[model samples]
Target: MPWPSPPVVATGFPGAVAPVRVGRQGIYDRRRTLVAYELLFRNHGGASADLAEGAEQDHATSQVISATFGDFGVGQIAGDKPLFINLTRGFFTGELPIPFPPHQVVLELLENVEVDEEVMAGLRRLKDQGYRIAVDDFIGEPGRLPALGLADYVKIDVAAAGDAFDEVLALAREHSRDALVVVERIEDDALFARCLAAGADLFQGYGLQRPVTLEAVSLTPSQLVCLQLVRALTGTDVPIREIEDLVASDPALSLRVLKTVVSAATGTKNEITSLRQAIVMLGPQQLCSWVVLMLLGGVTGVDTESLTMVLARAAACARLAPAVADLAYTVGLLSGVASVLGMPEADLVDTTGVAGTVREALVQRHGPAGAALRAVLAYEEDEPCAITGTGHAVYEVSRAYLAALSDAMLTVGAVAGDS
Candidate 1:
């Protein structure tokens, strides 16, 4: 990618063409509700290679800020929550007068970022502008006390916190009682419990979602019914009666259907009271969308973050390839559904009555739909990836995936409000 001088505003800049992409990992409150997301930045062009060598951090950081705030607005990536972004010392001091809304982003100062008079002054300026600051991977550096004092959040690595874990926590508490302590890499239940007992305000990691692998895992009767309901909704011949009956089988689901109909009803004068009427008014398309959301929500044993990622990836894949959008979505959702349910992906394919094309994509990752699925997964890994035959650049796929995070948040927010 061509590196041009930083623009004043992230929007409508006339510069050399280069694909800018971003990725995000959600940060959850104690209740597992998404409070923020840590933004991962990458420049798909050759300039980023120089960035990796520490020569072009300024240009790379500028592009990331511009892309999020200007190219794809903050509302498109993070709806109502703050975006946790990593900031170098250069961005802290040089990249001044931010153009994006301060409340929408949390600048995470890397551990190595200096805490000097100039840096502190920059931090003060950012504070004046209404932005929140977080100290990333804090390790209780005595010289960085001023930096710690300004932190709104302090992140600690649970896996690597050997003998100094308590010391770090003490220093953080002593410095700022207001700072939320976030413990990452809590890979198992024991560590999670330990962190909770030690008074962590927020937690993150794949462990919360995967927890323990059951030795003889199989789908329960209720879960089977949820999958079957999704199958019916997505089938060529919409099983309207079966779909309605399946939804009515669960009390919570029936109430959700009623609320959705009542809230989404645009022109109808009378309020929708029953599931049958709601189903008809919603139509097959809308009904299927709601069912898929409900089914994923009902998947037991998985944490909320993992479920959100699954849906977000599906939405992103759909946007990447609109021809087989629905199929791509199903592939993405089912990819994790088996793990969440403690069963195998193949078993889900056989049991859920998923279409043959979708099953092939899930089981083998072949065909056009599989090409899209591979691209989505690779982007989620936050690494370099190339999906052959997609006719779209990998960076474009990355952009789509980042955009999907907002959609997932909105859908989940609506469900939470109704509940």
Candidate 2:
């Protein structure tokens, strides 16, 4: 499999050395877990925060942002920046891979999904637990109203979504005036002005990170091991002892764990031996979540990483689902299972004999249930994700998804308890 380039931003370039490319995502000024001045940079088609040359100030700033958020070449965030990460359906279900701190991150929900009631309640629970939530495409919907009412922030596109937008913002304000409403896709000055007039509290789009060419970087074997362990830890049946053994399998991973355990940064300064101790110390739930989130930064073995992604996406859905439908719960994570394993999605489909709706979702993105299953991919790309429509409609659908996920995990945990 080919290696994908790591996300990067030019640290510095002579006003002449290929200009720095940046794409921006607006964070509500009132956001507690997001950076207001967040910038996503592109160098060629890749992300390069390493300023081999250019202005000293630009170089320094790039290092701070990239190092703080781009895994710092270790697949981990710098801990200083507001935790901002794209939230996808897969992530909600525990089907995809993640590589950061969820407690500190803000999940920017997209606007293309088919959410249900279960997903909404689950989201409410997550929100109660301290996770910040934001809805993209702040459109209105009947079924989605329940979930939308619960969101902390709402985002809209002034040019496309409009006074229809104001109506939605007004609605959000009516419920939670403190809820930050963001206007995305601001093309020019006039639109920006309109957004201000409409009470938009945040902003995003090409206005932030420019598209650049890609530059692929090579990784050492240790990096590979760390990623494998992350994948292993995330498996539905993975055990704490298994995770410990995998980490202990390689000296590099051992060192990474030691550093993480002792890093005054993570706020945990505990000591452990072997991998099991680390798992026990960290707690399987927290340990697994951290390992998966860390891998979100970027890892080697494109295929494995992609599989990890599919899994993470599915997992996110699981986290959201009220009832694991059509094996959509497991199939969501496993549908892409073959791709990452280097086998054919077709063969996996044949062997797993997954339900037709699920297979349709994976192959064509068509089906009512698929909306719940496939939304994971849409979430990963951060594209418009819909779960009914804007307002509380989509929110309700998201809640339905989360409910199913909670049920599945609880059932699985209980079964595991008996074992």
Candidate 3:
């Protein structure tokens, strides 16, 4: 039941490889319910923003957007909640492109941005396209008065605003009747109560919840190739074989595409052995989303050993459970993603849209697919007793494991250009 490996083709596109990180801080409503997160730029795993201050603002903003939507995934980071991302002059003035859909994010215009007629015109255009604009770190400055009229959310820094906080809050309420006044830097219980009493719509600060730093390894393929594939997939009436051919060019992309499609198709009876089947089943829009994410996040930085183990587990699952090889393979492949990314397994499943029986197998290890995964895991740990309850004999499991190991090594070698 081992799936055939696609030929590894070099895209000849230059790509940057490095670790990416972003900071996330929750913004709560009056009742203290988490509503949105203000994504920040972080240079390291620490909570301090010092390192991020030294980096170019535009680069930092780009990193945050890419890391949130691309690497960590919006679903995994914020679930159904909208993200509040700070926009520099480049983004606000339309000098740079915002890759995300308007509905998924609230565009925050930083306090430093010069809000002129040109910028206001850009804001109007974005608003017309359904983007919600937020005026960040507002202090009722006369210079920024023009932006308040188009603002959907007006954020005020309590610590920075000092005594003007109340006045600015009132001004925000008066200028933008529909805007949600977000009070930031609420450092104490007293401050939180004060902001709540002042009719603040949302609250954020270190006292409420400190920012958490999230990091991920960049993929090896060039951004150009990933973007090219994304553009092709997004184009009208594109052939399925064309998209499949583009995906088959990269081994890592092919692996993820197959795993995602098979995992989501939990009820399908047919075995998805080729990239074309996966592309056809996933559809162009979904596949395009995956490629865009890959373009933004790059590939996972799973080491050779970790990737080989994941492939081996997938191969073993397929061999042990031929009746549901696709589902088993998906479970086995995705089982290592969380470990590699240092995220919760449930979060990974939710992020990837893995649902129904596949979700149960990955999260709770239920059913035959789960049993197969459990048996493989137990065999890996040399726990013969644990494998007994999985309805798989030790001898058969041993043979499957050995064969899968050999197959996995060859696959890994091929991907690594060692074969």
Worst 10 residues of 1 by lDDT: 5-14
After TM-score superposition, what is the CA distance of residue 313 in candidate 2 from its true location, in Å? 37
lDDT tens digits, residue span 1-419, model 3: 54233223222222323566888899999888898998888875555454233126766676676666545667667877888998788777766666656766899998888899889999999999889999999998989988999999999999998988889988888889999999999888899998899889999998789888877653344344466687887688888767754564443455456555644333467655444566787777666665654554434332456556656777788788888876777677666445444557687666555446767877798877788888888887767889888999877887887798788777566555531
Error of 2 at 231 (Å): 10
Question: Worst ten-residue run, lDDT, model 3?
Answer: 5-14
Model 2 per-residue lDDT tens digits across residues 244-337: 5455433223323433333212455443322344445555555554444434433222222332344344555544443544234444554434
Candidate 1: RMSD to truth: 21.5
Cα misplacement distance, residue 70 of candidate 1 (Å) = 2.5
lDDT of 1 by residue, 336-370 (tens): 44544455778755543335666687789876667
Ranking by TM-score: 3, 2, 1
For all candidates, what are the clash counts? 2, 99, 1
lDDT-superior candidate, 1 or 3 = 3
The candidate, 1 or 3, that scores higher on TM-score is 3
TM-score to true structure, per model: 0.44, 0.46, 0.62
lDDT of 3 at 43: 74
lDDT of 2 at 342: 47
